[model samples]
Target: MEKEYTIRELTKLCHETAQEKGFWDEKRNIGEALMLIVTELAEAMEAHRIQDQANFKEELADTFIRLFDLCGGLEIDIQEEIDKKAQRNKQRPYKHGKIC
Candidate 1:
């Protein structure tokens, strides 16, 4: 069986890999990092548009990796934030009071 990693673990792993690859050799530009993640999502959208299942899945993974790396670099506790947001969302009305 494969080992399961929590979101925090994945964050650490992704950040460590990025650092090892010299992504952190110098101070990073937050805007550029964010845009790169957006680029990955765009790639995923293109893959989905063409029904390229394999590439679509890979691009989705890339998105998460980039997000995790960002969270780790900033020392943000993503799991805790997710839990807090989810709890708050649970108290909201259907669709957060939105139509359509």
Candidate 2:
């Protein structure tokens, strides 16, 4: 069977791993952390462009790992925020009033 974890659990796990690896030994630069996540996504995009399915999937996972780590480090309730944003998005019109 596959392992299952909630968003909160994953956040904790990711953050703990990062801490164990000494990534959190110092106060993190939030901007740099966020950029690292963006870089992961950019890598995923490049992987997709080149049809590297394995790398694309790995990069996508890296993106989420970085994001979850950030949220964990900052004590942000990312799951709650996502739920709230999803609820708000559900109330929006198609295309969110944009043309094109």
Model 1: lDDT to the true structure? 0.98
Worst 10 residues of 2 by lDDT: 91-100
Q: Give per-residue CA lDDT, model 2, range 1-100, as digits (tens).
A: 9899999899999999999999999999999999999999999999999999999999999999999999999999898999999999999999998997
lDDT agreement with native, every candidate: 0.98, 0.96
TM-score of 2: 0.96
- The stretch of ten residues in a row with the least summed lDDT in candidate 1 is 22-31
Off by over 4 Å in 1: none
lDDT (C-alpha) at residue 58 in model 2: 100
Model 2 pairs whose backbones collide: none
In order of appearance, the predictions have TM-scores of: 0.97, 0.96
RMSD of 1: 0.7
